[model samples]
Target: MIHKLLTREQIEKGYIRFLEKNPLALMKVNNRSQQIEIILGKKLSNIQYIETANILVEYAETIGIDSFEYLLLYAVESVEERQKIILLRDELTKHDYSVNKYTGNA
Candidate 1:
């Protein structure tokens, strides 16, 4: 079974990186040139993740039910976490966590 330990973002990034490094394998599995572009997320396409699934099977050390689903979920989760961090950082920069300026009472 693929480790559920990995968060969504890690899987997504790893999967994308895998594609970048292994273009020939991608082309062979996709069966068409048009589909490959879609997988890269360069063009609006739904089949990108699906195509990645094939690579997973070939490269994955192990596989089980809903492997692709899990990977996708982790990827999305990772992205959400990053967005939250950005927003939080912005808020932190705007204000300091300190005692009220007017209230002299500590």
Candidate 2:
């Protein structure tokens, strides 16, 4: 089930993390955020990285998922804060794969 979860910006951070790991996604999540800021002509907090993962987990039960462990796994790999922009390609691609497969469209 789909829950009203993860804002595009947060998902973008996940995409960013995925990119850093894969280095081939070419999906510029940071750029996307920047462009969004430019389009709105306003600045937004950079808390999207930390916030999104938490938000996804908070609402996880509603979505019939255990936790945001899949996403959290990368972000909290070593008990140290990591840059969210680093994994835009790989992890996000996996998430996309999961989505596609879940929908039986893969």
Candidate 3:
């Protein structure tokens, strides 16, 4: 589930927590945010942007950095698209070894 709407200060605090955990993820997060801006042709609302950032950070923590970048790219799409990508991601992660077994030999 997505988070409650966050104030600017709350968002900043959340980012600080993310930074404390993964310093290298900052650049990737910034790049993803910029891509979102380009796709939308304008900046996101504070709440939208903050929620996106939080989602990315949380996913990065669970999924590892490489896969998280791919996830962030999906996040640039519409909400329905993001949800679809997330469901696919969850399924893939659940059957990660099985996926690799098929793809690795192909």
Candidate 4:
């Protein structure tokens, strides 16, 4: 199970509403080697929270995710758990290699 920043109703509705309104928020997940390096010259920080609801959405785009995983990105959130997710994503990419495999990545 994953920590939640919103109720069931909120997750259902809010996730859709967010995607509809801020399509760009859905695209900020992987700037690691490209734009961030080009614009910022260096990674100032992890790709935590870039735009509206970005961090939470990034959390959703992970492999084998349930509803509330990404919202767990918090002050009390464990870095190890997040590392596991990143590893899972990387492993999946090794097989598929499609950005659109995850909706949040697209």
Candidate 5:
């Protein structure tokens, strides 16, 4: 067995790269208000959004399901925010595992 530990920068960069891939299916732009609304399609919250692309979940673990949503709720766009997002994701993941170690949705 082999395991590769990833650095914080590597993880952060991976998240940034995922966002660059345009995983979102739809986003409505309100030109009048200069706002963008995510079309979760059928999924409810940002957590549900991870279902669309399970592999991408970690990137949003610290924050929501994507960069745009993270920016929206957190109202920030910077490395500091990314760090916070990553921290949040790890905490949530840990909590979830402790509660439901078996039969996890993943």
Candidate 6:
């Protein structure tokens, strides 16, 4: 878990550094390449204002839930989006152990 809260700039910088070391992670997500370009401040493609919602979702599911809250607070700008992330993070943390699956309607 991340102990200290990171500012937006710090979070972006860290993400960029991470991508530099693990470039394949970014290459795998080809659909929204513009978002990555916007964050990097390069004039690769002119796209709408980008947000971290997709990245947050992907990371939270594939990485670790412990860092979800921190990532949401640092990367997400919309209050509504942050609220959704918080709720999802809480649910995942609460159910971190159980692996029950639904068989059918009962």
Most accurate candidate by TM-score: 1
For model 5, how does the per-residue alpha-carbon lDDT over 1-88 read when each residue is reduced to its tens digit? 0012234445444444554554452221112112212433432433333332343544467554664343323233467765775666
Candidate 1 per-residue lDDT, tens place, 8-45, comes to: 55666756766666787567545643556655645523
Per-candidate TM-scores read 0.37, 0.31, 0.36, 0.26, 0.29, 0.35
Q: Each candidate's lDDT (Cα)?
A: 0.53, 0.49, 0.54, 0.47, 0.42, 0.51
lDDT of 3 by residue, 44-102 (tens): 45434554466555766676664343343433335665556567666766677677788
Which regions of candidate 1 fall more than 4 Å away from where they truly are? 1-3, 29-44, 60-106
- Residue 96 of model 6 has an lDDT of 50
What are the per-model numbers of colliding residue pairs?
Answer: 4, 15, 0, 1, 3, 0
Tell me which residue pairs clash in candidate 5. Answer: 61-89, 62-85, 62-89
Tell me the lDDT of candidate 2.
0.49
Give me candidate 2's TM-score against the actual structure.
Answer: 0.31
Return the lDDT, model 2, position 6.
39
Best by lDDT: 3
lDDT of 6 by residue, 1-106 (tens): 2223345565675455444444554554444666557577755433211333345456666765745564554456677867875676567655553433333322
For model 5, how many clashes? 3
In candidate 1, the residue pairs with backbone N, CA or C atoms under 3 Å apart (3 or more residues apart, or in different chains) clash, namely 8-74, 8-75, 9-74, 9-75
- Candidate 5 Cα RMSD after full superposition onto the native fold (Å): 12.2
From the highest TM-score down, the ranking of the candidates is 1, 3, 6, 2, 5, 4
Candidate 2, 25: how far from true, in Å?
Answer: 5.4
